[model samples]
Target chain A: MPHTVNCQIDHLSVNIQPGATILEAARSIHIQIPTLCYHSDLCVAGNCRLCMVEQVGADRLLPACATPVTEGMEILTNSQKVRHARKVMLELLMSEHRSDCTHCYKNGRCELQNLASEYLVQDGRFIDLVPFKNYTIDDLSPSIIKDDAKCIRCQRCVRTCAEIQAVSALAVAHKGAEMKISTFFDLPMAEVVCTNCGQCVTHCPTGALVEKNYIDAVWQAMDDDARHVVVQTAPAVRIALGEALGLEPGQIVTGKMVAALRRLGFDSVLDTDFSADLTIIEEGHELLQRLREVIRDKNPQVKLPMTTSCSPGWIKFLEHLYPDLLPHLSTAKSPQQMFGALAKTYYARRIGMDAKNMVSVSVMPCTAKKFEAARPEMCASGFRDVDYVLTTRELAMMIRQAGIDFLSLPDDEFDSIMGQSSGAGVIFGATGGVMEAALRTVYEVVTGREVPFDGLNIVPVRGLEQVKEAALTISSPLPEWGFLDGVTLKTCVVHGLAGAREVMKKVADGSCDYHFIEIMACPGGCLGGGGQPMPVSDHVREMRARAIYRDDAGKAIRKSHENPDVVKLYEDFLKEPLGHLSHQLLHTHYVARKRY
Target chain B: MNGLRELVSALAQKHGTRRESLLPILQGIQAHEHYLSDDAMVEVARALDLSTAQVYGTATFYSFLVTRPQGRHVIRLCRTITCVMHGKNQLLKELETLLKVRVGETTADGLFTLLETNCLGQCHQGPAILIDDEPYTRLTPERIRVIVAEYQQKAALESENSGLINS
Candidate 1:
């Protein structure tokens, strides 16, 4: 058992764990201490001194976020001296910050602005240093925009990139007053090894980093009479879009979101979950073909342990860091791209509308999807496959702009022909959902039985573990797939690029053997994506994951192959999985990139 | 570029490739090449398994580690209070005129570069200037002229010897 330490904070006695920081102890007792640099997901930086508290009998005030709790320690959290120090710290931070709050994109949501308002730091006690510093704005990347003038130099983005993602695309570049987070050689983010993950954008406490929104472009597309605007919502957006509005985390707002989109003048309200089901069909068959080639034909050149390619961030990461292992990645396009390609060709032909007159838009819980849509190779439909990609936050902004009362809005169903999905598609928001979905179909195809689990849950690989592994022994397989029928198919599931890096290292060193691997760049899969709601933590991620599973459990159809619309799609158009048309539209290739 | 890669590899071999050895490796490169070129920093970053921005950040934190090209001879005039009080401006003007280049600039022939630095611990001997790590104290216009001429002569002689060897 861990030792306990007793401490008195503002005359409230509490017993906390020995290693807990003073900030944690205060939070346990509901004593809210304002902090600027402190985040629940990052390490203690202690640079921002806004959390300084007065310790009895100590000459200097201790930073509450960095100092540990001690036995019988008397701490005054909101004393006169502490309050003065915090106020002065807020004033100094505002002096350096560009205080054009109304013009900023994150005016009300910015942490520094909120603290300044709370402390009543309206008086200009210090000179504004923003005008003097040579701050530059880098808006070159399609995914993220970085404004140095609004930065507080908290290093939260730097830590998020390095610790969680293992991609140190951003780093502290200089010292003292000149110190700022910069890319390699201060190059533009698009030219460097950055994956455009947008984790940095979500972690930034100020307006320094943010997603490049396409709200105006979407609005213009909708307003144009010549263009038919069709929007598809990703599965993850439904679980977390409510958080940006007034609803709590884990609220399912799918029907409400569809209603708001319809009200906002979208020509057709579709679902990316439909394409997610299509992906499982194609990817599952591809996996089975590889298994047959390796096991039955004894092929040496064919790569085993194929990794999923649904995440654009993970795709870019592999292209940069592990370029030699490019063959291991599956060639199937992401669900959004699949939907985009189909919207222009298959959906356009069915609706009797010219392909050129249709505009494809997607609402995703990711920023990298913007970069993915803009790739040179994504124009497979003879035009730009996806004209615009909006994050979940941007969709909420559009809803508010349209004056739609999303909270009390009536629930509505998605439009037909391309809007239907299954429970497997709904669970794609969580970490291990893809692997679980694939097994549910593949096992039934091979053994002609449901997955050997209670209610087809696949419990072992369902939660937020960094890396999970599972194996199943094939028995009594159908005659076509019976290659001894005793092989134990091995699989691995990993979320967050750091865990993916570890698994890739093992794959690189030829140490591990697995048939399939699922990798997502952001933590907790797409539900905790970089473009999700702000103030993301492990608790919020867990709530979102629970909501995804709940949605999956409540669905009538629980398997992707059983999704009726997908069955109709294959029968009417594509003919079969990995057919010629599927290869041309639903699959793509990757390019190797420089490591630096 | 290949030579720079080899030099960085040699430095890494001697100093080890840990993060703490970054400073010594960078200093070694600057000591040999007279400046930390972009290619040199890139090589060091590769050797130490660090990002190029991190290497550039460390290289730029110190005033002594030059990140740009420099001439064969660098003249660092002290810009401290005591040196300024004791006619350092006149010394600077004399050097600029003699080298035909302003402060922080190299000459046309790339023979001399002039720059200003913080105190060199020679306040007692005011108006001190360091020429390629060699200090000259109590400078004047005539003294600055003689010192620059000596450096010019040394360069000429060394180039002549190299020319003879090539022939």
Candidate 2:
């Protein structure tokens, strides 16, 4: 057993494992020492002195985040000295910070703002000495904006970009007064290797980094009489949108979300899950085609271990970092684009409305979706398929703007044709959902039996593990899939981009073999997206994942191929999974880029 | 690297191309090339198993190390309190008039580039300027003109011989 250190805090003694910081020991006994730079998901950077604690014999107060507890150490967590030190730190941060909280995007949700209010710091004692850095706001990227004035140099965004995403687009440049977070040689964000993932924005504690707002454009479209503002909600948004509207974090709010959209002046409320089902049929068949080429024809040139292309951040990541392996990525567009294409062509014609007159909008649990919608190839119907995309937080703002009582609103149904979805579509919000959805259809179609898991849930593929592996043996495949019989299909799910980097390294060296790999750019898939409600922790993501799986289990139709509307979509417009029309609208090629 | 391939490759071999050797490699390149070129940064990144972005970021963080191709004679005028208090403003104005360039610009003849920096740790020698690592202390406008003339004369002679140092 490891040696333990006993620390006395606020007259309560607790024993903790050696090498534990005072912050960890205090939190174990529920002492609640506050810290600004300390995050559950990052390395301990003791730059912020917010969590100062007085040691009995020490000359000065020590930061609880970085100071490890010694044997029989007596610590004062909330003494006058610690309180005064914390207040001064908060004042200094506030003095340098560009305070326009009332108009800032992160106004009520900022961590520094909350700490200042809690500490009762009326004003700063020192002069605001931080000089005005005249960097042009990088609005060149479609999704996020980086403002230097509001940054406090906490280094959380830099850590998030490097440690989690494996993309060092933001780095701490210079020293002391001139120090700031910057891209390579302080280049404009669009020219750098930023994947437009917005993970850095998600981890930022202040208003320095935020998603590009589209609420005004959505409002303008709603006000225009000729424009029919149609709305679609992503599968992940339903599980997380409630948090933005003051409800609990993990409740499935699909019905209330649809009702709120109707009240907010959208002509028709639709579901992106419907197109997710169509994506399954298309992507699943594409995988089958590759498998047939490799196994049946023994084709060496065919790309194996096909990667999913549903996450736009992951797509762009591959584009910038691993362009030579582009052919290995599935060509299927994300569910958002698939919905946008069919909405303008199939749904508009079915409703007897002009495609140009309809303004299609999507509410996603992602910032990359905004970037995905603005891509040049997305204009399939002679117009931008998705006119504007709003995040889940933005939808909550719209609901508030409309003065709708979201909690009390009646549970309403989505409009018919593009509204129907299956449990497979709902699970797409979680890390392993896409892979499981594909397996559910692919297994049954090939072997003529449902997946052996309880309620068809692939338990191995589900969880918060960075990389998860699973193998399934195909026995007595249906006559058409005779080549796959007795073949043990290897598969894996990579939850975070850092994990994907490791998986990619192994794949490149032929160290690990897998027939399929599912990769999500964000930590816990879309439930932990860059644009989700702030203060996201592992517990919050787990709660949201539970809600997603529960919703899937409760649904009547569990497989994507079983979704009625998607079958009709294939029958009426698409003709087949990878037909000429499907290729025109539902698939895209990636562009290679320099890593620097 | 067409011109610097031999020098950079030689320096990289001496330093053994590790992450810890990045600083020494950058300092060596700056000493030989006057500034870090993007191509040299890429080469260093490849040798050290680091990304080019990281290499560029580190190079830009220091005040002395520059990224852009510098002038033949790089002039660093001290902007610390002791120097600023010692008629540094008069010296700066006189130098700009003498060189026909502002604080960060190179001369039209590619002879000199003026820059402002913090402390040079020579508090007693107030109002100091470093021209190619040689410091001139307590300079007057007349002295500044002579310094400019010396670099300009050398630049003209080097250009005539087709052996200019700026490249």
Candidate 3:
């Protein structure tokens, strides 16, 4: 009957909203309730049990996070008992967690580390209490490392993996102290349909889930006199690399990033955007050919619903979850791979260097690209196309290790030949971006004229919505194209494998009728990748997404097809789209894996 | 279906198959089958993966898996919980008497899996178990047996044939 509930904050009476937690009510009046497990973006699981407060007439102190505040309830947040309980909770958590924070990957930035310092937990009572036998290692995956020894069992990683990313790759298996977060059936991470998006790593309170560091390999490459090390930075990497340099989260550091790479011993600082534009040129041609085949005979042999093959995580998902739809995926390798291939071939010829002497490195915001680099199918360049794959964080660490003053370094341009790219190429950092980019080029080729859409935003193919759809009307000069012929190019965009699963269901049931689809393994595109930043939220996603579009808008070239470097690349090296050279280097096939 | 004697009789009526062929049959059903959607015996009978009699034989064999369409609410009480507490004997006695069924038997109304498990891996919460797939901590015999009975009564209302039981 009463919506307003009276609750006391430190024995002071305050009316609060019904169904509000004690922490929520306390925070309204600036009463700080310290929390470790409570991430604003995620639902409260009350696992850490650190947010405890004493309620009058209650036998035991209540967990403020789990407890709902009631009317006329007196609460004591800083009582002796409450302090003791929170301290004990922290002690227990610290005991189970690895205390060697100095050497830990999450040393300075870990939430648990911050909590321990804030709570003044000098040492744990059970400091030497070894975690149970389940503190084993599972790092078969190229991108992820799972060392349960450091895990706090906060379930933040599990919740983020399931709720935010919607991959649901990790779950608490077994139970109690022996329980550990794991992929389905305790299978190796590489064996599962885990898109190496790294959301789990971002959400993890400790160093349990982490991106596999390839900085060592990059260092080795730099040390080798015979090796010509080339580095390509992903668009999203430029926007988020600032955070690693102690700059603001959304700060654009493209110039400093280039200078940092030059300092880090990269022979050339290339842009993945250049390769992204190339992907558009080649993939755009592939789409036209496929469309011609579809129109010529409408043969089922032709993969009608062509899915973008840019994200390795999505490629793996296609391999595992939608094996039947493998035909639908584009044969073109991702921009990272494409860049590596061109550096070995086109760049090698221009510089009069041997391809084997060149080591192409990619600094990406994605962990899946690590897996993609290791893939047997990715050696299209006669060597590993991209030899070393480092995340934005890893590159930042390397930059710091190399004593590069990242923040102070003036902005610099990427190397000529492969540095020039369009806004369409830069937008590949966001979800539905690849689809939007592909449509921009494909629509023109299909109609023999530029399609309408100011700045080519393609409003329907933009946003945080998991699945986005758009229809394009084809017209003019291309013989097959007529005024409307009712030829609406049906397109769908899916981010996250869980969303991919729903679309997959439609394809499996023969109900999905989209002509083209774009799938990103990470939610919010590569911007929310596991390797981008720690504790990624809607704020980070928005910041990074806005920064990516901003980078796109600031670009001199805005359309992928119109990139002069790409045009020259086609004429000088590629010969043409779907050409002998392009096919040999860029295209790949997928296989159906048997789950045992 | 209520007693071991009646269960034996039902097995006799259902058996055209031999016992030796059961494991593969059960494994096939678990694998090829999406969930335990078919009658355990019928699924056993259809295992081209195995012979019908062989499947029936396996269906009756494994204590870990179910052979019958289980209750809508399947109570997977951890025997490991009680055993670790050294109260398993007492817990089993209480559960059998309360549910009016043996440890391995489903009630006349199928609603629970009252079987003994080696370990659900929850040693800290000794005498712990799961009810309808949700973990219950610090389970006592009196509380657990009652929980099982409530679950069985709930499971009986839903047609066991159409529902899919994971455990």
Candidate 4:
């Protein structure tokens, strides 16, 4: 009935908005409540009762995460009863969990391990039930590994797959103690419709789900004298890699990252941004050609509203859920894949190294890139385009393994050839960045001038909105492109698979009219990727996005076509955009897959 | 595959194609197919516009909605506290011996499947076993043998009638 509810947490009075949960009220007062199933990205599941708090005169302790605050409610977040209950809950979770923490990939970063240490939970408090249960570890997927033994039954991954991604690839199967997160008929993740997006891995509280690490393989390649290991870092990795290495979010660490990669024995440290510019050239040309075919040629076969295919997760999502709409996807390869293809072919020749001896590796802020690199069709250069893929977190682990003090490293530049990029490529890390980058180039190509936006910043398509839209009316076009001087280009930018699904539904039913759409599978684009730093929230994504835009604004060349390396790439090796060589290496097709 | 699609579509149409319709559609399929096959679940998911895994999860959550190959007649024996207290174990052993199978196994002839389920809301009639849709309550080991024999005889008679019709 009132706009505010008054509550006392730990004898401290706090006034919070009505309909606020007890957890929210406590948070407003800075009273920390430890939680497991309660993730910032998902709805309250309330299955894990670790956040229980004592209520005055109540017979049972209330789950703080699920219980709403009432006026005059008195709660104790860390009373003796609450502490004992929390400890017991931790003990129970540990009893069922495989507590071999030293060998776990998430040993130091596991939330459950952190809570157990904070609560001083000793071993042997309860009998270990892991040996009795037939737990399985599914490592078939190239991007992720799911271990049922370590799962705390928190249902975070299930909720993430359903709530955030809108792809119910994971669900709770069976009931009672037999209940577990399972795919259809408990199929291996590789065989199912899993997008290989590691949002579940990032959301999991324990080491139940994690990216399939290729640290050892990359190290082996680096160590082999016969092999020349080349590493390309994605634009998103530069902003978020700092978070995993103890630097604050929004800290630009591109120079430090290149320096660390060099110190880690990479023969050449390259930038995926170089290939990102190349993608812009290729994808921009593809969009113009499609537009020409549709609008000027009056071709009915050309699909309008061509979608960006830079995100492997979004590509797979379209393949599985909207196979009929595959025709609308752009044929340009992603930056990582483009870099890999050139590294094995053109770059290998320029550097006087055999393609077979070069091991192309990519450091990305996505788990899906691992699966992308392993795609059979990715080997356009007569070899696996990318030999191994490492997430931002994995690169951090390698940096730590090599004993490199990442924070104290001196700034360094990438190798000369295939290492230069522009501001447009760097902004590809954030949501709507691809759209912004494309508009900056496409408008210039069409009108022979910069975009009409102030300071080349497309404000409408650059935010955390679920679906962002912007319209630019083209006028005074170049004579060659003068089909009509007054054609308005409608573009939509969306991040997160859920938002992508909504946009795609409109595209499928012909409900909305748009010329181009940029879709990223992860929330906040690649900066909030499933393979980025853990503990990702809107605040973290916002900070990383700020860093991306700031990095873009500071660069001398703000357009993709202005990148000198890209211009040289076309001049020396590839004659033109969408030319014969470019088509052979820079473009790919999609496959329709079973939904199940 | 086409028939399954048609059946799921028909069920979806009857129940109204919404999230709530998933359960009734699955029930309708299980009613005819005895258990949900992979193909059947995929068809249901397609008709309902849901993921196959979500359908499988829902099907496996309920004991009655089986998700594997099942016999023509399913026998669900209550294994709750009341039924256990009322000598349900002895009745189970008698049934297993007569049927020549384990607790979760089906008969060699594929006529009957025996499974243990939680309370069937027949606590008043403890030691109850459900065969097909019928409930036989207050069962002893001797009563279980007789009930199984009656079903076996009925199956044999039906087979004989079918054989004659085919000839």
Candidate topping lDDT: 4
List iRMS for all predictions. 1.6, 1.9, 13.6, 0.6
What is the Cα-based TM-score of model 3? 0.78
- Which regions in candidate 1 have their CA more than 4 angstroms from the true location? B135-141
Q: For each candidate, what's the DockQ?
A: 0.61, 0.49, 0.04, 0.90
Regions of model 2 farther than 4 Å from truth:
A1-3, A129-132, B1-17, B38-53, B77-105, B116-129, B134-157, B160-167
Question: Which residue pairs show collisions in model 1?
Answer: none
TM-score rank, highest first? 4, 1, 2, 3
lDDT of 3 by residue, A1-596 (tens): 79789988897887888999998899888998888788876898987888988988888878888889887899999988888888888889888777888998888888888888887986737755664454678888899998888888888877876676555567675555566676654567776657677878877878888888988888999999998998899978988988877876777788888888898889988899999988988887787788768876676689777878998888876776567878888999899998887888888888888999999899999888998888887887777788889999999899889987777898888999899989999899899788888888888766666668887677788888888989887755466544335577899998877688788778778897888888887888888787887767777788888888888778877789899989988888787899999989888888886321
lDDT of candidate 3? 0.77
* TM-score winner: 4
Model 1: DockQ against the native?
0.61
Q: What is the iRMSD of the candidate numbered 3?
A: 13.6
Instruction: Report the Cα RMSD per candidate.
Output: 1.7, 2.9, 10.7, 1.3
lDDT by residue for model 3 over B1-167, one digit each (tens)? 13333333344444433554444435444443312333443333332322222333334334445545554444555666444575656666777787677866676755454666667777766666665457776667777766765665555544463464532
Q: In angstroms, what RMSD does candidate 1 have relative to the true structure?
A: 1.7
Question: Of the candidates numbered 3 and 4, which has the greater DockQ value?
Answer: 4
DockQ of 3: 0.04
- Each candidate structure's TM-score, on Cα atoms with residue i matched to residue i, is 0.97, 0.93, 0.78, 0.98
Over B1-167, each residue of candidate 2 has an lDDT whose tens digit, in order, gives 66666776788899988778888899999998888998888777767756666787788878788899878788999988889898899999998888889999998877788999778877797788999889888787888888888877877786777754454
lDDT of 4 at A546: 96
